[model samples]
Target: MTEKLNRFGMGASFVPAETLNEIDLGPLKQLVGEWESVVLTQTDEKGVSKPLASGWNVISVPGVPKFTFEVIPYKENLKFSTVAVHAGNRGPVLNGTQFDQEIFGLFYEQQIVSMCDTDFCNGRGFGKDTVIHAETGLLLYVSNINGGYNIARLGTIPHGNAILALGKSAQANNPGTDFFDVISALGVNLDGSIPAMLGYNDQISGIPQFAEFQQVHPNTFLKSTLDTIIGSGSVTDMTVLSMSTSHPDATGGILNIPFIQSNVTATSMDATFWIENISGGSEPEILQYSQTINLVFPSTGTVTPIIWPHITISTLKRMQPQPETNEPLTLSAQAQSNTPGVPQL
Candidate 1:
């Protein structure tokens, strides 16, 4: 019986998700439970996959995780909550420094995310702006997604264990340093005082190249190459939503850039989830996904596109069912936060 209890985490039942500033969790309500999470694989030397810390046993990584439906009141008509694992845990690579700690945990493979009205309305973002034409209690699915605020989640259960993947994003074509020459080629700059960048800075919009990039792709961008099993499971359902090109990269994968920001990118993100079944069965869900952000670097004096992708895969089991009174959560990657360069609320 203890073994069975271990399979199903016990943290969820203890947390209270009844309300946050009078906001309801909506479709995401089911996530208020415990789960057995595992970091199954990481990029290997040959570009293959291997266990995250093969050197260590699975017991050290922490299995059972409980998620709390918490939120922050940002602005009018925009309220949100956070859900993540590791309760103050840090990654192995942090070297004990606080860089990959606290808020940084949200960006981890299994980290934080928010749920608002838009996720329920079919991936279409509904923040301070955007008119979501919902009829009384009806929802319409649209193709256009925009909002500086966005979320991508990969939920999969491999071998009866769950894994969550986060697809780094580019709110818009935030050109950074690599494009200085390109910016110069456009013959546009507020003044010659500005320097090259690795990521976007809203205050520096005086530059033509910077302003134009945002105007060109004014939304969260994403692209997906869903082949087969990213890790394991049947891949019951998966969706890659929204994509925009950063000048060089959205993910900081290109570390060798001139500046310390990040490269332009076409990010990929996972959308939403609800318990697929509750018959007390253990079936795996395949999870594999990534996004594109055109990477340009001095490759032998020339430049080329690197397959820079943020991907994850895993399997999970339903250790616990959604609270009988708990509502299921829904998510869709149909929008980007209009206020670029700001995801903190």
Candidate 2:
């Protein structure tokens, strides 16, 4: 029998140890599936076609243009698999109360590919539809010792950087303005000029020849979809999870390898995810996320270290439900094992 204690220390509920499948995933249950970006297209009166991709990335790099800025349109596939349920955390007993906690975690893999053709955005081409970014991470659903709940992300990037960010979760009727404002205020337009927020005193140039890359914020792709859904009165439910490397209530940050740290050091990261349930749409569940990473480029002979924002945003539709398995989880070994602080084996 396993005794489940509540935050109040009032009573305990006992259940058979074999019933490990009966788990509460909290709000993270909405993310349990495979998702693919919802790519949209728009054509102007002049008959020029623009691909409003589901994913967009804006970053500053070095090239023939001194400080070269690239706006990348991309497609992404993100898959989440259930890793564990009811992962326990033994808490301390303060005075007379036990502050035990449990976690439900999901492991995710994200792959992003460029949607650009050759010579479209300078010769800094990632090739036609080539893989641009890949990441593996874990999303944890945890119960805070004090009261409510916490959501934490453990992500490993192939760019020699690792991140751990923590924050609270909310289920709301509509997403707050903060989610839209931050991105709109800082997003780079397609005119080939960086946002004023970038704080570059000199005139920065290198606008792509295509109008598709010239007139929208990275998050505008997501907002367009959201606007259509909201206008249609189809949003039945909304869930928002916002996390950051500098969360006030938690200790979280990013770590970079020596090579990356010496050049483009990732200083901080902030991301927000909005999941909505549409009553009648092509897909029942839609996931939208906006992530911004701050990077510092080391100074050369005359230039000072420049802090640039790398932003990625996407709107994804759940393509499939979580993986189904008939075999029960092997929880006993982990639940009953206790090795000393200093391991002998």
Candidate 3:
């Protein structure tokens, strides 16, 4: 948790004080329960842009919790319903919904939380704003608004500057009021930072370059090489050839290189080079290339994973069977039994 206060000077009259304990946060907590917004950057495949509305559900849990934001699609009549799980080590589950089709293309969503320490005297005080600084260099301003009016008018001040203003305003309203006698205050040092919401950029894109070659044996060598290429973070495309050959002279030695559409950017130029001696035969020789080149993306677009039917079927088989039962006997016991009968005699 971050420290809440700075050291005070010996002669200072007003010291940095705790603000959370002074004011009631019930109303503020209630106000953050559900929030909705429409994002204007969402677009479709046809390059058509549309507004996408998203919803959020906030909750406070034990310890410092990282809030979550969820994206929900619009259902009938433009309403949304979705949930966001906190990304921290352990936090409460937050849910959200988006029923407004006007904002469906928005991908990035976030949740924010705030804490205050003082009270405002019915909007008449100076301590009306709660200012919070985020680790990402973002500043947040939170204020109590009631029925479209600032809550300072109601003598409400939770934990920030507004609390002092409310106290002064209250003193001015009543003459002969002792500042120390009438002023009530509390302070709280909240431990978390404000959430920074982000969204996907439609203008950025990536393409993958892959190498495909035939194999001489059904060994793990091919698969291992494929894994190594991907793990290197440079190869974006891969294809395994089905053949057995050791020399480049064989028809099966043909290598096919293809470019795959990808959303990831290449981290290095190493992927552009092919394994010189893939066959690993006696007196192995490296394949000479005329030129090596790295392909760049010619246009901006996004690439989503294409779900194939075979992959889906394989995943379903991994799930455990429900309401399982043991196999029954195929033959009846009586039929298998032999007895000394008159016909046999």
Candidate 4:
């Protein structure tokens, strides 16, 4: 017989050790199955900014009996424009002719690992630091070789299957702006003699010809996918280092984007976005718009536990001039919206 502690610490009780160990784990076991989610990220370097949604999932394996984390990103289609001084002394005018451009794209399928001590004790884990470009459809997969071990592969999965799945979904979903395909098809089209002067004509004129630009389509690119399994206890104790944007173009002015970090013991998640204005002359500004959403996880077994308890935070920031002063300046503002979620896990 085994002694059982009273819930209120008032009654004396005894129970068999074998009975205690025989407790049904069906509920927890069902909750540990494989899962897949998608996240959407959008950044407007032009002027108008949008929000990025990140998706997370956890899966369980038979042998290890641990949890593995996977993240997938979807890109928000953004369309906005800003004026630029083509020639010298030109006044600041709205250039509606500028083709729609997207500053950032959907994130790649990244593998997250759980670091553990003694394979099940206490440890920490981090996600891979690589990002996939939405426009060029290029996958810049970075491994442990480049002075960074944030993301590593514990095993290998079939490449053909993953590629096929990624391609089919990316094409079927078409999660980009309406004009994304249009602008991508027709690159920066400049008027006047500029195109010719830049030697963009045929060989006879010493100018370059617009042969097939060999534009990289959005669907052909493929990113690496990896998975890691860690002990169950490791999931409860998680920390977020910092959330950031990937390689941003210099064409747009200053940009500020807001992101949320989940599973954080702390109540707040902080994020910062950096932008460099290579458009020349003036600097850019950042404005922030925020919103929140409630999330609910599906119930599992008899007594299902809520895994994600935090609210989804979204923000959008851009560069603009001071309304009152009418001076060339940068302004940053923040807005927040909140959503509730289940409080089990």
Count of clashes, each model = 45, 3, 49, 12
| Candidate 4 per-residue lDDT over residues 195-302, each given as its tens digit | 222322222222212111112221111110000111111111211112212113211111212221222111211221111111121212111111111122222221
The positional error of residue 153 in candidate 3, measured at the CA in angstroms, is: 14
Clashes of 4: 12
Better of 3 and 4 by TM-score: 4
Please report, as a residue range, the 10-residue window in candidate 1 with the lowest summed lDDT. Answer: 54-63
Q: Give the Å error, residue 291, model 1.
A: 6.4
Pairwise lDDT winner, candidates 1 and 3: 1
Cα RMSD of all models vs. native, in order, equals 22.6, 9.9, 35.8, 29.7
Q: Write the per-residue lDDT of candidate 1 for residues 1-345, one digit (tens) a residue.
A: 334433564321212344322333322333334343223344656899743310110000001231111111111111112332222223355555553222111111132122223342223233323322110111111111212323323222111212222232322131211111111111112332322432222222233222112212211111111111222322343332222222232321122222312333222232222233212123342111122222221112223322221211122332344433443223322234442221211
lDDT of 3 by residue, 119-228 (tens): 31112111112111111110111132221211111111111111000100000221111111111011111222211223211111111010111111111222333333
Ranking by lDDT: 2, 1, 4, 3
**Winner by TM-score:** 2
For each candidate, give its TM-score against the true structure: 0.26, 0.75, 0.12, 0.16
lDDT of each: 0.23, 0.64, 0.17, 0.19
lDDT of 3 at 287: 12
